[model samples]
Target: MNGLNTTALVLLIIGGINWLLVGLFQFDLVAALFGGQDGIIARIIYVIVGICALYAFTFIPAVKRRHAVE
Candidate 1:
């Protein structure tokens, strides 16, 4: 709802797309931007994305449906 949450969502979406690309084509956009997969910056970006993903776990659509019924 706020900027931090929105930013986290965007990062998570980007992470998801990057995974899709990797799974389908062995490509990784985050690694490309932060420099190869082994780079510290790339690893940090990955960690942030991972954290964002964990943060988003509570926001999944199925929970929204359950909450709506209550």
Candidate 2:
């Protein structure tokens, strides 16, 4: 579970970076690497990023419990 959480966090960071680049420069790194937005590989990347977001949503609460200071 820890490994899964780590992987999700890494992907979320990647997705965030990609979005930042898109917002700042109108560039999509994932599309560039995978052959454009319409390509299957690019779509898979988008899907994985979204799934990682969902996983993070479910994970944060437990993470806080595990790391609580009190």
Candidate 3:
């Protein structure tokens, strides 16, 4: 995958892990590491993760095309 795709995947993984922690233990890893949930850095991370999730949608068509070619 290209760099941007790789980055989006990594960030999505991080966001997924953070959600898992929040669901299981009521913890917010990003907030905990950066500051509170309202902290600027933490908010930025959240926004980036959300955007990456949207970007991930683009992969659906690519995957379909790849499978069709095989």
TM-scores for all candidates: the values are 0.80, 0.86, 0.92
User: For residues 2-64, could you state the per-residue lDDT of candidate 3 as single tens digits?
Assistant: 999999999999999999999999999999999899999999999999999999999999999
Give candidate 1's error at residue 7 in angstroms.
0.7
lDDT of each: 0.90, 0.93, 0.99
Best by lDDT, which number?
A: 3
Best by TM-score: 3
Judge candidate 3 against the unseen true structure and give its global Cα lDDT, from 0 to 1: 0.99
Better of 1 and 2 by lDDT: 2
Counted clashes in each candidate structure: 0, 0, 0
What's the ranking of the predictions by TM-score, best on top?
Answer: 3, 2, 1
lDDT of 1 by residue, 1-70 (tens): 7887899999988999999999999989889888899999999999999999888886778678989999
RMSD, every candidate, angstroms = 2.6, 1.7, 1.1
